[model samples]
Target: MQIGNWKSTPELGPLYRQIREMGLERNIAELDAFGFTVLEPGVAAPMEWVRRLRDRLLDVAHERTGVPHDLEGGAHGQLNTQPHFKHQYILYYLLLEDPIFQQAVCNPHLLALQTYMLGFNCRLSSCTSFVKWRDEEGYGPTLGLHADTPVAHPIPVGKDTHTGNSAFLLTDYTLANGALAMVPGSHRHARQPGRGEGVDAAIPIEAPMGSLVVWNGNMWHGAFPRSEEGLRLVLTMYFNRAYLYPQEDYRRNVTQAILDANPKRLAVLLGLADANMWDSADGPDFRGAFDVLRAAQEEAGLPTTANPYEAQPDETDVQVAAG
Candidate 1:
C-alpha cells in the first residue's frame, strides 16, 4: 500500500483518530530507511504496566509447562513441553484471558506504528509471547534467520518488504539475553538470505525494557543465543494487510464480556469488526462480527457509524519516550 493517511469514521471513535496520527511521519521515515524502528520504553505503556504483563506471562508459562521457575533462574519451556508450538512456548488468545494483554496489544502508539507500516486495515494476525528461557534444560538458543512472510508470498524481485511485527520487550533486549539479532536494512535484500549469510552477519538489538521494536517480517533476523541468567521475554503482535486471513480467528476466541468491555478502537484489531473484511460477510447474517460492531457503541448508547478500517489524522503528540 502507498504511504498515506487513512480516514476515520464515527465507528472508529475518538481513540482511533488519535492513534492514527501518533508519530506517523517519523515512523514512516524510519520504516523507509531501515524497514524497522525502536520506540523507547514507555512509548507504548508505563513501566509498571509492562512489568505486570511480564509477570503474568511468566506465571502462565510455568503453569502450562509444569516447569518450576523463578526470575533469577528463568522458566523451562520449549517445543518438547509444548507439543503444538515452535521456538519457545506460544501463549495464544491471551487477548481474551487477561485485561493486561488486551491493553498491551491495543496500545495506541503500537497501533499507529502498525497502521503506518502495514496499512490502515491491518489485521493483528498473532498475539503471542516468544519466551526465551535462560538455563532451561536442553534448550538451544539458535534459530534460523528467516522471514515470516516468505512462505505465503515470496518477496517480489524488486518490491518493498511486506508484513510487520511489534515486539514489546517485557525485559530488556540485549546480547546477554539473546536479543533479536538482525542486519540493518536487510529487509530490502534481493531475496531470502542463504542460511549462514544472514545469521553470520547479524547484530543484536540492545534496547531497554518496555521498548517496542517494530520490524518488517521479511528482514533477515533471528534471536541471539541466551547467555544471561534470567528470562528474556517479548510479547509480539504480528500484523498483515487487511486482505490476508489471520492464522487464528481472533473473532471467535473472544467472549461477549470482553467485546462489551473493550474500547471500540480494538474491535477492528481484535477481528471483532472490520470495514472491508468480507471473507465471511456474504449473507444477510453478516456473521457475528457485524453484529458485534453494531453493539459496540459508546457507553452512552450513541449509534456507531461506519465500520471502515481506515484511520484519520490528528495532533495527539506522539511521544517516542526517548529510548
Candidate 2:
C-alpha cells in the first residue's frame, strides 16, 4: 500500500515543456527512438536568415582561402589540402568570424533541442562549416561511421549525453547532394562501429535548405559522396555537457562586445557560466555560478531577479595559443 501511494506522477521538465511549446516533441521523440531528428525549414529559423547564413559562409570561405568557388559546377574541388576527406572544405571557428554565426547559435528552437539532447547547462563545443562539392574520384563512405564523442565503449545511457551535434543545412540536402548518412538507432549500441560495420544500415538524411538536423553524440554518422553539380553548404554547431572540454575556447576567447550583443543565454552556452575552469589569481568567480542558476530558473519560468554579475568579466586580455 505504501509503495503504490508514494509513487508520484512523472512530469516533463521545464525545458521539455519548452520544447513541446515550440512543436519539437516529435523531434525529441525521434532523437530518443532513432538517435537523430530533422527540423524542417522555418522551424529552426526564418528562410531569409538561413539564406543570409549561406551567403556569409561563402564569403568567409573565400576570404579565408581566397577561392572564388564555382557554385554551379561543384568545381570547388577540395582546398588543395588534406581534410578528413576529399572534395570538402572544413571552416573552423566561424563564431568569431561574424555576427550572423553568433545569431545562428542563439536560435530559440535550435537551442531548445540542443538543451533537450544535452542538458540545461550544455556548452557549445564548436561552430564550423562544411562546404562540399562533387568528387571526381567518386567519393566512397569513410572506413566506418564514427561517433562524435570520444569515449570508452558502452557509453553511458540516459540523459548524460556527453556531446551532441547539429548540422544546419545552408543548401538542400539530398542523397544526390552527398547528405549525411546515419545508422538508425546506432546510439543505443554504445560503442563505435568497426571498419565496414553498420554500412548496410546507414541511410542518407535528406532535408531542404534551412532545416536543422541533430543527433545524439554517440550515434554513428558520416556523409555520402556528393554527386550533384553544386555546393552542399552546411553550418555545423557542436555541443557538449558542461564538464567536458569544448572544441573551441569560447570562454577564454569570446569578446565582451559579442557577449553584449547577444542574450544572457549566449553567455551560458559559451561556458561563461562554468566556474570549474579557474586559473585566475582571485580564484573562482562565484558570480558566474549564480548567473547559471538564474538562467536555469528563468528558463523554467520561475521568477528571478537580475544577477549582480550580469556583466561578464572581460576576457579580451586572455590569449590562447594557436595549434
Candidate 3:
C-alpha cells in the first residue's frame, strides 16, 4: 500500500454515536479484522430478489450490447479489460429503468452498515457491476488497489474507511471462478497500492449466489482470474457521506411515485436532501414528496437534523398534511 495523508477521525456528529449503540460491534469487529465481510446469502438477499436484479441487468446488457447473452455471459459483449476504464459499460448506473434498483439501494442490512461506517447521512455513490465472461477466461485487469477516495473522506485510518461497497454476487464465486481477491486489513495501511502491486497477496473469495460482501472502500483489492467455465457477475452499490459527490445523479432517475410511496431510505440514497429538492408546486393533487419523506425518515430512525428537508411556504401545500 502506498502511504498517504489520512486523518485519524472522520467528520461525524451525534448520529455517529447513536449508530454505535445499535449493537453492531460484532460486524464492526469483522470489518476491522478484515477489510471486508460476507453475509450469508439467505440473510443478505433473498433468492427471489436476486433473480429479479440479475434478470434486469442481463436484459439491459443484452439490449445494449446486441448479444444473445444470459446471466451467465456476465458483460455480454461490452467487457473492458483496461484497468480503471472510465467508460466501462459494466459499471454504468441502472436505477432509471427499474425500481428494483431503488429497493436495492435501501437494502436493510446495507443501510445499517453505512450508517455505522459513514453516518446516517450517507448517500449512494454508484450502483454498478463487475462482470467477467467465460470467453475472456473470466479475468479482467486489476482496477489497482486504492481507497474509494483520495483522503478517505476524512475517516481515520483505523476506525472507519468512510465509503463502502456492498457487492451482491449474481452467480457463484469460487477458487476456480472469477472471484474477488483482497488483502485483509489493507484498509488500515492508509494508502493505495502502487500500479500492479499487491496482487500476489490477494486471496480468492468463494461464495454462492445471492450472497453479499460489504467492504471498506479503502481495501487493497482487485479481481482474480478464473480457471472455471462460467462467468462471474457482481452488482455493487457504493456509498459515502452525503457531502461527498455521488457518482450517479440518482434524484433525476427516481420517479415521483417512488417518492410518494416513500421507501424509508430512498430520499437520502437519491440525494434529495443535498440538492434541497424536497417539494413540488404541482398542488395538492400531485402528491408532494417532503411530507412523505419526513414520515419515512421518522420510521427509519434517521435524525431530523440530518434530513427532514423543509420547503418554503409557497413551494408546497403538503406541509399542512405533514403536520
Candidate with best lDDT: 2
lDDT per residue, candidate 1, 1-323, as tens digits?
Answer: 23333354342334344444464556656766776788888776889998998888877777766775565676466535343433356666566658888887777687766765665446778888776665332123334576666344346635454577878898877787878887778878736676566655778889998898988767777777777686778788888776677766777667767756666656666665553444454532333455555554443143454543223323223232453
| lDDT, model 3 | 0.67
Give the per-residue lDDT of model 3 (tens digit) for 30-134. 877887888777775689999898888777667766775555434355745334432233747776667787777777777777766776657888888765655
TM-score of each: 0.75, 0.85, 0.75
The residue pairs in collision within model 2 are none
Ranking under TM-score, best-scoring first? 2, 3, 1
Worst 10 contiguous positions by lDDT, candidate 2: 1-10
State residue 222's C-alpha deviation in candidate 1, in Å.
0.6
| Candidate 2 vs. true structure, TM-score | 0.85
CA deviation > 4 Å runs, candidate 2:
1-12, 77-84, 136-144, 158-160, 292-323
Q: How many pairs of residues collide in model 3?
A: 1
Query: Which lDDT tens digits does candidate 2 get at residues 151-200?
Result: 77677655346888998998888888888999999888877788877888
